[model samples]
Target: MAQAGTAKQPNILFITVDQMRFDCLSIAGHPIVETPNLDELARTGVRFDRAYTATPSCIPARAAIFTGQSPAHHGRTGYEDCVPWRYEETMPGELAKAGYHTQCVGKMHVYPARSLLGFHNVVMHDGYLHHNRMRHNVAAKDHFDQVDDYLVWLRQQVPSADLVDLGLDCNASTVARPWELPERLHPTNWVVSESIDFLRRRDPSKPFFLWMSFVRPHPPFDPPQAFLDLYKDAEIPEPPVGDWAMQEDPMQLGLNPVTDKGLVPKRRLKQAMAAYYALITHLDHQIGRFLQVLNEYGEMNNTIIIFTSDHGEMLGDHHMFRKAVPYEGSARIPFILNDPGNRLGLKRGAVRNEVIELRDIMPTVLDAAGARIPDAVDGRSILELARAGSASPDRQQDASLDSAVQGWRPHLHGEHAYGHLSNHWLTNGKEKYIWFSQTGQEQYFNLEKDPLELHNAVNDAEYADCIVHWRQQLIEELKAREEGYSDGEQLIAGIAPRSTLSFLKA
Candidate 1:
């Protein structure tokens, strides 16, 4: 194994996709979607089955991954755009300081649209951000031509092509359509093309940190026609509606394409599901292309690869569409770490059930790179646990097995600010407890028994003690916050939530 801060440090490739659900991968036993490349990646690495995103939205979730801080520490608890990314310690910044050349080929999702965030160079494309498009002037700093490198290349390839020419709203509409242009010109293909070019042009003397962020399966629900056909005949399961999620008037909210919670027509929902799954498979193929290039460059064995997403898409789960909800679909994400060189001695094909989150990404990458984790980072490295091998089979049935792995947090606390959907939750991978911040509604789910969370068991007398334990845990987590969600005794509802906290505003 190459020593840290040495010339032989392994290359790190950090891959992120937007709004991909945890159960979407066929390797994870999804009923419809096929992700052979991702399955292979997991087969050669460690897959954390219980990974989550605390904030469960693009901006705030990315903030945690980049800064290694919790949502409270980073102060972006919800989905708000245009907030400046002012963190001093970032994953790329620290890696750059340790003599690694850093490059990002896709979504940064940071302010100024072109902020490098310590990367030596960034080939940007943040996928039709309204904040950038709303500027009336074509020459505005945040305009597509000014910030999106892919748009510039697309125009050069096909002079009249535009991203919105297909007429799909990037975030609001759940409409499904195949790519109107040539498959090669699709944004997913473009991200991989640019990344391959980066690999060819990267500095050979220094170990590189490359972040390939894909902004797909998030919205517009458009995949290439061929990919869409891959799932046309497949049996796609309907979104599970929890007993607590039935709407009083399903049609009232379902008519609105942008509504967060609603019951859309069965056909429309199925079409959207097919398109979403198609986009994921398309992304998987593109990733395979990138991996082939890595092997061609002879860097496959000496590289450390990590795959995850900022958060997950609700995709009609519990009648919820889009993100910012503390439910399993919005908060849970797929996390896979592959160290082909065995530098960390991580057991191959180990499926760990640890309650990992995005904040842990920074430290894990840094630990693998032999770079110093910033003191400001609020996450712990999972290298030791990874080195400890997979948990024993009896571990799931017995709480006593937890002592075998040291330094693992007992549970994870996740939250989001989405008006009525706003909630705080605590989970240890087997069970979950949630408290709706706006309505004081409480829910409990035994994840081991019901992974889909089809039933809410908060009022069940059998788990009464479990509910109380998680409630107290959440109370302690929020007691120090300025919003006063808790009064040190119990949680207080109706406290208006802020997207970015006052400390960050200052």
Candidate 2:
């Protein structure tokens, strides 16, 4: 076993899936997707059930994950063309400072889409592929449909495949798109290939950190025939559907008619679902390849691998197709920590139902790497939990850290500012409070009783006090964080959340 600082530090391999939901993994008990590689990692690592993204949007969430700060603190809330590197502390930057070789591949969504904050090397593959022509100077020529590349190649590989067009974009009908698929085509396969090459070719003397961010199971809902066929007749379950704000609380907001209501129809739901599952399986296969390379190099035992998604996807959940909501389907993400040497108390096949957030990852990796846990980090390290390989030590240590790090927030906070709308979420674990002044609506949900968030409880007089109490708690918590409290305790007790002002906070 490798002890921190006594010998060479272990290499860190962080893999993040773009817009992958919590329920997409087999290890998380999703009956459909065959995620054998992820299951193996979970079986040999610690899995966090209540893990959440601080801000569940694309660019903002990615910014927060790498910075160890919230979107509110970093100021990259919306789809800005370029990230302002001056205001953030990215993971690679810190690792590079500590003498580690840092590198990143695949979808980073850092806006301008090319901001290399601090990685020693960044080989970007794909990022923030939105189809809005008017949003910026987007050229139709530069936009290469990833699905087309995969489909064309699959056809040549397997000649007699019966695949009908599942119409999504106007481009889906056009066959003019090239058909010959290169070996290094699909974003997942391409990224994984680069990742494997790095693992196999890196110098053993210097420790390395690689961020293999996969941009799949996201959208365009396009996967090749083989993957699409994997779940062809596999009856997949559907997300819950009920009355508007039925299980919602009064504090929630923006219950639009098009979205945040219910599904469109059964046929379309099934088609979209099939495509989503196909993409997931394709991405899964690539992940397995990346792992196979690690095993081949005999580095699987000494390397620490962590797998998670930037944020959850709301594939037809709560009447939503994409993300930017506070529902469990959109907020919760799969967080797996696999350290083979039991470096952080990680036990093979142990799962923990602890609540954690993206902010925790920076400190956790830094702790595992024997790098300094910067004073600026606001998250608690899960190193203790990984060290003992169970919840017992984590629970005991959590007790000592609660006053400083472990208590459930009286209100969890989230924000979104995109497409002419600003949305925010505040929750107290069991109940969620949302206020969207633009739509003049509030939504609340007893998440514990209504796990699907089917009913709204905000307007009910019975839960009136609960609303006020949680709202006040939100204000206090926000104030404390703003006041410079790393974990909203004594660290920054003197600084108030409201006092720290950025345009994003508004």
Candidate 3:
């Protein structure tokens, strides 16, 4: 924890991936994926084994990261298109205030599609989104438009290239194939190259904060031909399905096309997993290149790097094909924090099992930059936790508790108003409780015994009191939301669904 005014600020490099699962990487011990690059990165950094997204969807999850606020405060409880984002504070805005030059490249899923959110400048590339360039026009020009920087550069490379040529759908398809464009022209590579270019031309006088956001591994699961071929013949494992997951929720499944509506045939599930893992390896390789570029620039030894995803893809877990669910496959994300080993005193190769979430990123980085954290922010800086192991008790914020006990966050609340219902989560990694708003259904998973959520323990007599405790906690949490999902004492089932955030009433 470099909170000392005398501690020098390290340049921050924040990297992100879309729809990447928590355990899909070799670093996380995935049986099929061999992510040597990410594994090496993990060895240099501290990996948070219990990190998660409070709102496990693109728009709201990113909002938590950027604003350092819970969904209750940020007000995006689900995925919605064209919703206005008018937050008063943001991570990059505060970083820039502390004399750090902040810039971003790649996907920003922010609304109006081009709002900078306080970055000095952004070379925006929100990949293959339907609403941004389509959905409300007589002449919809999504892939052909130059307004998206990646699409424009792609067109310059091959004047006839289009998104469909890759043989994958931007939104719904779970199909797999080799990328139609050259490997260098792939969106994953393009993002890194653009970031390296920005680094070369960045003002060297100030410490910089760069967001290298990759939009791959989200959809259009088309990795380069070589990456795909690596997994073409491998036996990719099928997503774990819970005993209670046999029954599908039409509210959630109906949103996608028939091909991806629910758990299709096992063969299709295997192909989807194979393709998805291929994308992870491809992204890992590009990350290796990005790190090499940093090393060549002589910045690797002085830079702080953090890697995580917006949220996890279900990949057919619990008959769920995409996000907006409360399962571990949908909510758990890969979160790694790498402090420059020579310049900073963070524990090397430490695996932190204490719970953390996306909102925590803002304050952690700002504290590292030696910036003043806003009083309104909800995240606690994890750097302080890392330092607590070595710092004496009197100086620690939670001096009354041991650092190991102090790092434990009692619980985190997660909810999303998708699937035509509110899927809410309450968990601390040992056990998880999910309350689906439509049927007033409850699911309990003992994550200690079944990390894959293989069996729903909701009816087991052994866990009755555990369910009541969590449910009451959820009740108190929902009482503050605009939707009347709870009556302060019990949950209210099947209230008219609301997707766009609702204003807290006077």
Candidate 4:
């Protein structure tokens, strides 16, 4: 019999896309992108309109998904390398211990590159790692030969094939062009192909967890020629320019991170966005193919499907390019949960507006598998919030978890350690207050009135009190962190917080 308080184990299919914007789907009212397959998922399940990545960067955001802990608790405050992940508690570790066959098909960006967390096996393909592939490193030449499964297959398919032959830079977020290679050979297609192959090779008796992570809608902006043609004549809207974005050239402003998008040309932005949207459409079609395979195998009935992103790209919003800042373009993400068997009693196609975070993924997966969440976990299970009368016997961590499940997530704190202009944000889904920790500049936006963040009302008399309240809230939040961001009353900038917590042993 299944353990008490645990429902029958259901197959969990968690899908993630890297650096995708929130409004890229047709269902989300996007003007250009048409993601019919993703829209179908939203139509059949619950879509969260206010989901966020607590730490809006690659490594920190992914760590929250794995450990069920906030960036501060997990000890990875920002993007870092060689930070050994030795956590005894992890999402897959808990699920694997509960007898589920967990496997990750793509993009496990963990240090050591091949660390499985707790997965029994992984068909590895993390798109790019600047740290591992450093030209000066001794193992640089042999890096792919030793660690990359996708590259091995690519070479076998076409011995002369090179990622550079397509004239794309994996790290550059600038250009947009039609994919020079065949559609079937694209990285996005390869991830789906491998995931389908896994379903064919799995042990049918055990409930399974599959992570199909995609690397596109990210950089180099190359979609297959057909997808590009689909949007070639579409009327893509101009990006909503902010009141403060008249002169965005970070070069002119002397911004420390020179890669800032303040000065990108108008023509380039249009091409980049066009290609970005096409990639989403292509990705959506691949997902549709994946779903068709699952249906053919008769596994969709009992499986719980989830779709989300690691973090959002700015996509030229507010004159920003990549993540690491606290704007909605960089922090907000798409979160959809399709419970095919209606295990949670949540109304189908319901739009849940409560604030959600990536940290919540671990406990939610554990709860689905009849596995107990540990006291060390800081994230709450969304399922706990949907069902009533679920309370913990212990009140210590229960108090924190209740806030989310009970719809009491009044505030979510976020930050990033950029070189010259570090920033932090506090939001309640309806409004936002941003603080430039280094420069002491503040930006306030009422998302209810201005979803585009066109105006900054920090100095407006109408919102002076609202600004004061969020500022104090930030002060209290930083007091809880080890960074010493504030005194009891006021913020104290310039105290550098360590990337990895000192307590974490390698």
Tens digits of per-residue lDDT for model 2 on 435-501? 5424535678887788777877888898899877765555554454332323532122222223123
| Deviation (Å) of 56 in candidate 4 | 1.1
Per-residue lDDT tens digits of candidate 4, residues 361-474? 888878777788989888878875543322324322333345545545677887777755578888888899998877788899999899989999999999999999999999
Residue 275, candidate 4: C-alpha displacement in angstroms: 0.8
Model 2 backbone overlap count: 34
- Candidate 3 lDDT over 1-506, as tens digits, reads 44423326678999999988899878788899978878877787778888999888898899998999888888778887667677778999888877778899998987656778879989878887776556565343333274588877888898967776755677654566678767999889999999999889887877889999988898888888888888888977666777877566555553343243464656655676787888999999999999999999988887988899999988877777778788888899998888764455566666766678999999888877888888878878887555433232344333422654464578999988876547888998789999989889899989999888988899999999999999999999898677788889899989765666666211
What's the distance in Å from true for residue 465, model 2?
2.9
lDDT, residue 323, candidate 4: 84
Clashes of each: 0, 34, 0, 2
Off-target runs (Cα >4 Å) in candidate 2 are 1-7, 128-184, 245-263, 386-411, 418-421, 477-506
Best by TM-score: 1
Order of the predicted models by lDDT, top scorer first: 1, 3, 4, 2
Q: Cα RMSD (Å) per model?
A: 2.3, 7.3, 4.0, 4.9
Question: Candidate 3 — which pairs collide?
Answer: none
TM-scores, all candidates, are 0.96, 0.79, 0.92, 0.92
Instruction: Give every collision pair in model 4.
Output: 248-262, 249-262
Error at 349, model 2, angstroms: 3.2
Model 1 regions more than 4 Å off: 1-5, 136-141, 247-251, 392-404
